[model samples]
Target chain A: MPFTSIRELLPKKDLVGFAILALIIIVLMPLFLDIFRLNLIGKYLTYAFVAVGLVLCWGYGGILSLGQGVFFGLGGYCMAMFLKLEASSPEATAIQSTPGIPDFMDWNQLTELPWFWEPFHSFTFTLFATIAVPVLFAFIIAYAMFKRRVGGVYFAIITQAIAAILTILIIGQQGYTGGVNGITDLRTLHGWDIRTDSAKYILYFISAFLLFACLFAAQYIRKSKLGRILVAMREREDRVRFSGYDVANFKIFIFCAAAAISAIGGAMFTLQVGFMSPSFVGIVPSIEMVIFAAVGGRLSILGAVYGTFVVNWAKTSFSESFPELWLFAMGALFIGVVMAFPNGLAGLYQSYIQPWLKTFINSMLSKYQQYIPAKFGLGKPAQEAAK
Target chain B: MTTTHNHKHKEMALYIEGLTVSFDGFKAVNDLSLYVEEQEIRVIIGPNGAGKTTVLDLICGRTKATSGSIKFKGKELTRLKEHEIVHAGVGRKFQNPSIYEDLTVFENLEISYPRGRNVWGALIFRRDDEVRKKVHEIAEMIFLGDKLDSPADLLSHGQKQWLEIGMLLIQDPELLMLDEPVAGMSVSERKQTAALLQRITKDRSVLVIEHDMQFVEDIADRVTVLHQGKVLSEGSMERVKSDPKVVEVYLGH
Candidate 1:
């Protein structure tokens, strides 16, 4: 629940010490690498942030929602729209405002700003739009499906359908959304020095901080009653339902959480990349997010981060080098890991690292059972578990 | 003249009336009517495919009843979902030791407390001291106190059953419906399990569906024999053993 081992390693009392450790490490990032490399690393963090929700939804919930990219796209579009509007001077606010057309569209023959795109021009409104839209969509869909008790393969099909529809809508809305090309080009975060090296580093820090926060939040929930119910739904849904909990509410809540997080991650990605395209938020990307978690460790929060980094690193390093079969290589990795270690890399850690750690702790406890008296506290958990 | 329904006169923990479960037209549990009393260790003993589990499935909300009513603790259980039934104080233990085998025996129980069973509650780590103490007490009672730190899969078969029973115990349900709790247990383990069940039955209602008649005889307060998806006879084993119809059904001659 608490990332038990990490929490144990860094107890609440010693948190300050770890914070200082993190600060020192972060400060050293610029010292070891050039500004260009720092930006690259920062870009990676944005991708990791975007993948966080997918990890929770697919890895823990087993929903296999193939439409998470919809949220990502929404968030990205929201951020891009706000940045684009902010770029235009106040003097340019109402100048005939090209009708039924984006600026790029105006370059063709379109004349007026689509009414739906009007609200997004405001920074604050766009911010809410990004998060609220995705969460709202996810909530409605999850509620309808879960309330009716549709899950497993059927749930998967419905979500994939949603993604397909979203992809088509975004591509076809030539007068509303950016169409196939998607909103892009201009960028700046509230007119801050977006091109500055410090800004890039700042974004990277925020991404890392957000990742840690989400992990912490997920871990807490996993330890809490709500997580147990979800697990119960996964294992014995009927039991949880008879217990008086509305299983639909539980499913919907997690579904919304996943979508909202995915949206925020998408916003971060858009901010970092200075662009948005329909390709970025399609079924392919949605499936890829799930694949990352599956190969890392479905249920482990830390494993999700591990997975996002691993798969992305592979793609970045080798996709272009052997473009003819990069997907083949990626597919091979997925099959290989799933076949050999269903737990993913985290599973690898659990199966291998955990045993070693347990033995070490137990041995330490035995030696210090008296005198130092290791706080192994084994019996307490057992007695409690039996209840 | 006013008359109360004679059937509802008997207060029951579980009231099953004409519970028919049809699979594509064939009756899995046909015209099955049975009542389990509060705290009664009612054993449903029937041969394989006699719909012994179908009854539990219907009761626990695993399988839908085509036409019947199941009222547990005066609440209609037929309409409730599985997890809701669990919260309504009915706990189900599967034939397969259904636990995260990779998790430590204690961790499994840690993740099973009946509190905060919502998505928001799960995201917030709120551990009540009382639940923790109860878990400890259950683990000790189930004789798994020694192996608390060990992963569940590594535990012996008997211990795993004890652990699962412990999980059900933590919920502190009004009724614990266990299926084959001691199916493959060793003689010593069976004896230990029988002792555990006896201790548990003191407080909660237990309905065990077991194939081992000796195990059933060791634990059952009353036995109900089911045949052709119907309640063939209900009485003490000694009395049911003497019933001609029950004998014919069991012998199948």
Candidate 2:
């Protein structure tokens, strides 16, 4: 029933868009690229999760959160903790001062695991915590800022500050958190070696599957009445409030949902990249995630996914050749997108490419219409097609 | 004072007393007391800066009252949030049209249909037959039935005003407060709006703030003249227009 409802909610054009994106990511990319490049693409797709969330939260809901990395980091760290625990089996860490505890803790002279780390020993708990912890943290931040009506730039700055703070805290608490190096040397998930090439391939599919799930969830929210309300609130908040909606609650929900989605991406990142670091949890990465959404067309969910690919692909290629100039290039790209094409790649496609493509297809179909039998009715006549 | 005694026998839809709102030591609405009876269309007329719009703002919870109580359907409203006030059966239309410009006229009215207002509810809310019917009904009422699918930004100035009113009407609030409903409307639009107001006010009380005396005379059941956030005069249009103090303070200009 929900699937049917979602089908009804998504228009035909959007379904086509989704299908094309799925084909490219799931089939073409894996088949064409080697395992190394496929792994890289998988890592990039993880960022698409954050971009998709931004499409709903910022584009639809008019919230500009600049600290999505914090949620992503939290999720990654949660999964990393579990993986670290699995790897730190008494036999594996027998040489360490404490055989059962993580190496970072032993290195810091800790005799036992922290209370928080103890639960990570259970895969089920760790799996739940990856999404739940980020959502809980997001809820708290959203409730505090939204309830006080602290929004727009202030909200963005506050979120950025939180990203900075979380990075510092993790770096400072080296003993418990793996510190600036982040939780590294994760080898297995429940006795299965995750470092193998086949493991990377499997993880890539899993990440792609999860990204689709999040995308569908976002699409559902975007088509629901809640989605319209978010747009309404963005245009005129007082009008929406006067219509009897508790505006703050909706904002909080979207923000928390965005956090959960970003966290999932973070978990995938940890799985695919084999490490969760402070570098990914800081303001820089959070802003970079926003750039992914912006360049894709902040308003287009599919655009965000493509945007993530384009920017990250550019980053990898550009930095490999001119590592020193990559930052300047990224800055130029953002400014160019904002100034020339505020709607990003999606808008450009919609305004220019889509219409022309439709016309070209229609003309081609009509040109061949006479060749086909009228009984078969393969294509409509030109006049009807125009209508 | 005499008008208060006269309306005291009737059921009160909205009773606001001692409503005061000060911003940085300037009282926008000062110690204002007003009563609106059931099914009454009360028009508030005053010069610019006479606190007419401020009165609507105070009752609708947009501006919190420093010292006062607003009773709507015998329920205290001063402590309620803006949306809570709306849910409590009090609707307010801004001085300028406040419809969502990006949405269609149908969407604007559908959003104000008074169901699935919470986050989870809105997520699961289906645009069922009843919602569609109500939306169409309200759109027709505001004379935007044909333009239901058109984006609100495409509407003319007068149509936008009507769209905002249609948004408020769908909520079916018992006390509908409109600020300058006819402001920027054409002569024909004003007449249509007056007639529209007369039709919708059949089951609910209306509180309107307007400057056009002609529009006021067409719809006002009782006129309240405000000056410096205080009631300068209160009576029928004829009596208030003739009042010496009202003439000296407001109409004389």
Candidate 2 Cα misplacement greater than 4 A, ranges: A1-7, A368-384, B1-9
Tens digits of lDDT, candidate 2, A322-349: 9999889988999999899999999999
Best by lDDT: 2
Question: What digit string (tens of lDDT, one per residue) describes model 1 on residues A310-336?
Answer: 788788889768877777887788788
Q: Please name the candidate that would achieve the greatest DockQ relative to the true structure.
A: 2
Q: How well does candidate 1 score on lDDT at residue A96?
A: 35
Q: Write down the RMSD of candidate 1 (Cα, Å).
A: 6.1
- The iRMS of model 2 comes to 1.9
Instruction: Provide the lDDT at A66 for model 1.
Output: 75
In angstroms, the error of model 2 at B120 is 1.1
